[model samples]
Target: MSKKFVLIYGDAFVDYIAEDQSNSRFTKFLGGATVNVAAGVARLGAASSFITVTGENETSEFVRNELAEEGVDLSFSQIVPEKEVSGVYVHLLENNERHFERYVDVTPDIQVDFSAIKNEIIHETSVFHFCSGTLFHPIALGTTRKIVENMKKSNVLISFDANIRPLRWSSEESCRETISSFFNMVDILKLTEEELFFLTETTSIEDGIKSMQQYNIEALLITIGAEGTYAVLHGEVVHVPVEKVIPVDTTGAGDAFVAGILSKIYLEGHPSTKEDWIRYIAFSNRLGGICATKPGALSAMPRLKDLQ
Candidate 1:
């Protein structure tokens, strides 16, 4: 049987989240968009495999341990003694919204090499998921492209999330251009309202979809927070709503959402019809909604037991 795991690639981050606007008191947690998704999928009772590089220091050890405890497979991950994991300081607003204050990285050049991944892993991967977090680094970018091309040849489903971090890119144009270049290659693309506007330079969702129609992407999902998701699947547009929830912290909600969708795809096969797509989107929205009701990113991700 195929491994049926969601293969994820990206950087691992140590998130220092502030308790309040003061930004004085902070708590550390295992983070990064891909980390959250990998853990979240595993929590939902699906197989998840992570591809990342970490250092030999205490912080890196903590990240590795946390991911292993979360049931994520790290057999393919690498350890670089000189690589210091990146850190992001997130500040909480009065409304409990999270804001990325700053980022710290000592060795951004260290990244996973495409040659390190075994052929068997690629053959077994049911879906390959990635984001834009590490694309700014040339080495990482090249590796990502190589891996994506290989996965495509193996007929694996490719999922791309435009998890845009403005601070990581040199400029808005560079970010937009770099991310847009991968549109035609992805099987599924997820973006936020702000990200859609930024990439397409359009004010409305309709126009944004119109602008992206040229890519002929299989599926495009626009997350609209509580309002739910706006999806464009095979030239068809649909609105999927979600249950309302008072958010305590919106951190990791998008990751949870993507996890839900990926886990569902891994457990059940990919959606083949409009109704099928809607069901998957609705399930994902519920996960996102539930995640927003709690604190922290990876900590807030819903588990299969939580749903039961």
Candidate 2:
């Protein structure tokens, strides 16, 4: 069975983000890039789903409900019993300088059966995706590798977002090795300026694109917020300038952009040309701008109507 559309294959967990306003603390809402991107795809009115190991706790249950509400089909998640639901602990962000207190490690023992989810979703999808963050973990990484290989057998276009969480890969050497392995595997690669800097080991965007081209990647998106974004495909580079907006909470902006790109390509039936890719980047940037103007990651992720 060929996949219907996009299938996000890893890291569906809670992100307990805290923001301190003056002296008061508040939760920003639960988030994770993979889930956010999956929800964003659904918001784009596309056939997209998520596959990850979820805990059978209240938090996991809540996360499942939240994802369902966001329109992400949850049939692909593997529920792990007797394990604590995972969450990211935080301190406060003063002008985006997020000072961390502690990172709560509630991650369950990842024992997912890759063939099960792949048999159901990836086998029928046009694109299969996962971020680099979770691939750093042993069990999830190993299982995801198997799934990616299986997805390849079905001719699924593998998309990878090297959403490098600073805390996850602290060392530059570790960052280079892990991220490159991820790029080497995926057909499509998308990363922000910060992510490209780390993965390519180049402060220059040109150098970054040059490095990625060596991986035989079909497409590479270099997202530069506010200023706009650029994409490289088939040895040509195209840039899309962003539409300006005052943001309320810029949480899921990047994922929103990714959804926008994928929506244009997979759903709208656009060709993967240099011009088309640039147009998709602009379309995605518009989606990201809209998401930032809203409050939460899920809440801000706009639907197809919002795009118009």
Candidate 2 residue spans exceeding 4 A from truth: 19-24, 90-102, 118-120
C-alpha lDDT score of every prediction, in listed order: 0.93, 0.73
Cα misplacement distance, residue 8 of candidate 1 (Å): 0.5
Write the residue-wise lDDT of candidate 2 on 60-156 in tens digits. 7887888888777777677877656556654445553233344555553565666566365655676777887676567767887888787777767
Which candidate number would show the highest lDDT if scored against the true structure? 1
lDDT of 2 at 150: 78
Q: Quote the positional error of residue 158 for candidate 1 in Å.
A: 0.4
lDDT score, residue 146, model 2?
A: 88
Residue-level error in angstroms, candidate 2, position 139: 0.9
lDDT of 1 at 298: 97
Model 1 alpha-carbon miss at residue 251, Å: 0.6
Give per-residue lDDT, candidate 2, residue 121: 69
Residue 199 of model 2, lDDT score:
74
> Model 2, 35: alpha-carbon shift in Å?
0.7
> For candidate 1, lDDT tens digit of each residue in 197-250?
999999999999999999977889999998999999998999999999999999
